[model samples]
Target: MSRTDEHRRLAVLAGIDIDNPELRAKLDEVSARTAARLGQPVSLVSMVLDGAQFFAGSFGLQGWLAELNGTPIEWSFCVNAVQSRTPYVVTDARIDALYAANPLVHVDGLHRYAGVPIVVDGEVLGAHCVLGYEPGEFSRSDLEELRRGADEIVALLASHRLPRAAPLPP
Candidate 1:
């Protein structure tokens, strides 16, 4: 299928959120589908601000996500995409000058990464990223599909603000 077609399919899938439970289910389904379609091991939807990373959705790979939260901005590929406000594809992180030493790349053995920046109202919010153990190349179509998913995530976050928990009794 064409990239635009794939993106449209995801957009339709994302449009089904009625509440938190539904949203979470759609996110999981989209992430899994994206991974399956792209033949990748890991697919992630993350929101990266100045100093924090939040995993809105993810598939494949556990345990390491906790480490990603509150991680330094400089160590993340998603941060790079957010800063640049563009798609960043690393075919071989071990060979890239900027990411060769990054813990996610070197220590974790993530050789391939493709990230599309999530921009909402002209401001970058975060990114949708996919990774693989072995090196891989991303096509323009793949990037566009990722971008569509990121846009949907931004919209969802905007529409449904997470409620703040009440304080404990004094």
Candidate 2:
């Protein structure tokens, strides 16, 4: 599927309020715990919306990106995972052809990233990812930890979703 199609589907499936304090707090806790588990300073439960990559949960983020809780889809690496429905890892975005023009690589100095697709109800939503300012590798075990974190985040999101209405009586 096209990126736009994927994003549109995700936006519909992820109907929970991003601004809900209770949900955001729970997501933030997951991000923080995942960051510690992976020994990374930064982690995010990022959702690729139709127009932006929203940080549904974030840890160790600073400055404007953190303040905004998101960025344009053009600036997002998580979108890669969403599109591919697979993990996206960049050991050094600075030199990676795919990210050479991405603003976050040059402007934010984010050189490393490892992300797993966040799938809920069998649809790819976005990513659960770790960020690093310096170049590095993500071991297989690290990806597994991220996968577990993604599962936890999916559960949190599901809990916040509004229940389906009962079918109308004939």
Candidate 3:
């Protein structure tokens, strides 16, 4: 299967669409704590899917971006984090030519970024991202802490009884 296809498949198998309010609350707590710890204005635990990303948890996220459960992958900076397979940091996207074209950088005003892959069963479930509205440096210790926090988030996900999509009534 194509990588995107496999990602979607594994996401479904891993209960990425879980609707458990209890678990969602925990995820929300994670998001809040991450944003506070990183001193970032926004943080999200996103599930990167085929064409979009669903917010499993979030903090300080709003606006038109607030109205939905997820967003198109093209608009998601965390997509890069999920693909990186390691903690990724963008010191300054606005001034960085490499990231100048990223929609999240130029369009949304999300500047510096630090994130880590959230893995389960050796598959990338999605990513945990801390988005700063201004350029800033992320130290190695900061990145390592982000990775550790991601591990804790993964632990919460792993311990849950994966609730799958229920079959539609005939």
Against the reference, the lDDT scores of all candidates come to 0.72, 0.87, 0.78
lDDT of 3 by residue, 1-104 (tens): 47776756566535643467877888888889888887889888888776889888888877766678677887667777777677777889988766788777
Best to worst by lDDT, what's the order? 2, 3, 1
Roughly what TM-score does model 2 have, to 2 decimal places?
0.89
TM-score of 1: 0.74
TM-score for each predicted model, relative to the true structure: 0.74, 0.89, 0.83
TM-score of 3: 0.83
- lDDT of model 1 at residue 135? 91
Which is superior by lDDT, 2 or 3? 2
Query: Candidate 1: lDDT of 122?
Result: 57
Clashing pairs in 2: none
Among these predictions, the greatest TM-score belongs to 2
- 1 versus 2: better lDDT goes to: 2
Give the Cα error of residue 46 in candidate 1, in Å. Answer: 1.1
Of candidate 3, the 10-residue stretch with the lowest lDDT total is 9-18
Give RMSD to native, each candidate: 9.6, 2.6, 3.5
What is the C-alpha lDDT profile of model 1 across 16-56, one tens digit per residue?
Answer: 33347766666667677778878899888766644566666
* Candidate 2 Cα RMSD (Å): 2.6
